[model samples]
Target: MTILCVRFQLPSAHETAFPELLGLLEEFTPVVEALPPDGALADLRGAERYFGRGAVELASVIRVRALALHGVDCVIGAGPGPMLARVAQRAARPGVTCAVSAGEARDFLAGKPVAALPGVGAATARTLCEYGLDTLGRVAAAPLSTLQRLVGAKAGRELHEKANGVDRGRVVPNAVSRSLAAERRFPRDELDPVRHRRALLSAGEELGARLRAVEKVCRTLTLTVRYADRSSTTRGRTLGEPTAHSADLTRTAYSLYEALGLQRARVRAIALRAEGLGPADRASHQLTFDPADEKARRIEEVADRARAKFGPRAVMPGGLAA
Candidate 1:
């Protein structure tokens, strides 16, 4: 086992501490991919040799260090590759690390449900189960041609390869993203969709203003909703165009919230992160013939100027008004 997939037991109140946990992992290995809101995947091939320890041993130290330094405890899974590591993680609990050695890779993957494989969505799992290929063992035994016929040529080939416990995936090193974040916490658990939208609107406006002030444009928006039970759901969307526009940010935030289909959710807080930042001047604005859109942009420019000259509170979207 060379890779480690770690899931941190981070509560919503401590959400901002995720980066520090990622940094701790980086001390062990450079190839740490942040699976945000609370987890990461770290490739530890070099670390094993350097630390004179196995992946599982290193995991114990990591767990202790995380708890000691950050007060964060994590469950870990170690395997030959990212896929196996992720599977091992599901079987692992806090204070323990599940390690899948190379010799047991095939047997370990064999009895798993098709849905256990990464990237195999519910629809794909249903389709595979319908064909009596309900488990990875069956999928591994199936002919490549048959799997291809059932799914697509490329997807079927991948499925067959992964079912046999081959590690085609590698851990990508995490790079720090230049991003802006804003969060709004409700006084109590909120279930109303209108209030949820209001929180999104508030966060978007803050992010957009910060980006514009810094002369940056962001190509992606991430939304994180913290629930009353301390769990959170995170979703990210690539924008149609890079933008520092408040309206565009708010609109995208609204769409992401709608896609969650959690109109009656007991939400505690909403946070928005604008990422993939770059020079605003290099970004192109989508031109539209609609006069309403044109008017909105013109008004937005004026509003930006007003906020700059006066204060952020000088202007606000009607929905965000107190």
Candidate 2:
């Protein structure tokens, strides 16, 4: 099975607009591993034969399509597995796709820095370097017992496994992020408490809308408030019932925000996260007598329909684009 890891190299001009580019990638393969707002890893194992092209040829086609459709360049690494694919992509500069045959993964990784090995963070690298393990080849050749003594049993075993290019990590299918998040920063910090509340509400609304669209329900809400001094506090609430209802999400988010007590504070941004997602169809919504709840959901359905037809911004809740 061949996996292709494509790193979409977003230019400075479109840095924050990478999700738009990911939408383009989704056209090629539904098994896209979103690296979120930047790059993606695609399992193109079965696609090659279906497309009647070799992996290299398909990579070229993808590069051409990305350039033409999104006006973006990418570095694609093609290999028989995820680790090799990721390493191959790292070897390619922007606008190129490099394919490594399965047989060459070891040679390709051998002379690279130990730091190039995944999971070898700075502290580990420093420790390894002190022991003359500057390169992957050296690490691979080292006594596993010695490495354990240096970096502990677990880290050492993992390092020995990866340095020898023995990664067995599967390309996970149906992997969804544990949390759904929406965040917005003001062009300038604001001191109004009402505006901050509005920002939290809007973020909540966005999160809820996304959950509904994706057919998921979340069991908890977390709100993060960022202040002018760049410090922030996060508060969370467990929902009484799992829901994708915008009003419920908004109320929870607002309560979490208010709990931070940012009166007369310089607020820079607000972030809301919905956590512990499950299938929306499986979730049970508690009955409520509040007429306002029904009204808000009715309005949300209309907004969703409008956005589906006209575009995402056509019916955004207040404070999102502010």
Candidate 3:
């Protein structure tokens, strides 16, 4: 089956906002696999007869549609399989399409650095270079038994096949639900922890409302803090129980921020992501004995209904009011 790998040049500030683009791709093919932030792989074999176009032509069509509709340009690479498609996509220029024919795949990969081959790590490249196997051509010419002795049995066999431009892996599509993320960027570098907590609270409230509105709950929460110097730190935690309640989500967000212990760090932005989402009906909420907890949940439901009718600004959490 032919596969097309498309890479998007998304701004880092708005990287998580691509649901509309994904929906658009779904119209052309059902086998769209999201690569998060900036890439996707689509299986185009079935789309050929349906769209009356070849793989390369279909890729160009997708690029044009994305540019016209979303104001986003894409680089697409088309090949018979996933590996070659990925390589072609990386080699493609912005707003362009590149394709590797079946016959030319080997020569295309021949003289590239060993590190350029997928699944070849820095340490592996260093080991190979020690033996003067700096290019894919040399690695491909190496005996399979020799590669196995150099690396290992499984990895060596895998690398040998990849160096020869052979990939047997299939493109698995729609494996997981897309995550929801909310980020708040400070106008200036702020070092106060109280301000950081407040920002996190707002982000949590926004994320919780979004999840509840869709009737979904997340199993994990990831917190990312971008510093003034452009460096960032990320931490994630899996909840004991999945929930879409604002209070529960806010509490988890607070805990994650506190765990970082950023006493005087100049923070630039904070982002929270709700991951591993599933249907709310399928998740089991733990029963609470505290009357206050029940009261809070009841109030949350009422607020959600009011917001649905009036607007999102109709209700606001007490902490967020300031």
Estimate every model's Cα lDDT from 0 to 1.
Answer: 0.85, 0.75, 0.81
Model 3 stretches with alpha carbons more than 4 Å out: 175-322
TM-score: model 3 vs. ground truth: 0.54
Clashing pairs in 1: none
What's the lDDT for candidate 2? 0.75
Summed over model 3, clashes come to 0
Q: Candidate 1 residues 1-322, lDDT tens each?
A: 7899999999888888888888777556556788877889988765654344778999999999899988889999999999999999998999989999877888999999999999899999999999999999999999999999989999999999999988789987663645657789999999998899998888888777767665678899999999999999999999999998888899999998989998579999999888787878999987889899889878877877777666666788888787
Candidate 2 vs candidate 3, TM-score winner: 3
lDDT of 2 by residue, 1-322 (tens): 3677788878788876566555444333435577765667776643443343566777787788778867878888888777778788888876666777766767778899988876678999999999899998898899999999999999899888877777676565332445667777888998987778787777777677667665678899988888899998888999999998888898888777777766688889988878777778998877687798778778988987766556556776656666
TM-scores for every predicted model: 0.55, 0.52, 0.54
Q: Per-residue lDDT tens digits of candidate 3, residues 1-322?
A: 2788888767766465476677556545546688887788887764564334688888888788788877788888888888889888888897668888878888988888999876789999999999999999899999999899999999999999988888776677672445667789899998989889899988887777767766778899999999999999999999999988878888999999999988799999999888877778999988879999999999988887776666566788777786
- RMSD value for candidate 1: 16.2
Candidate 2 is scored at a TM of 0.52
State the lDDT at 41 in candidate 2: 77
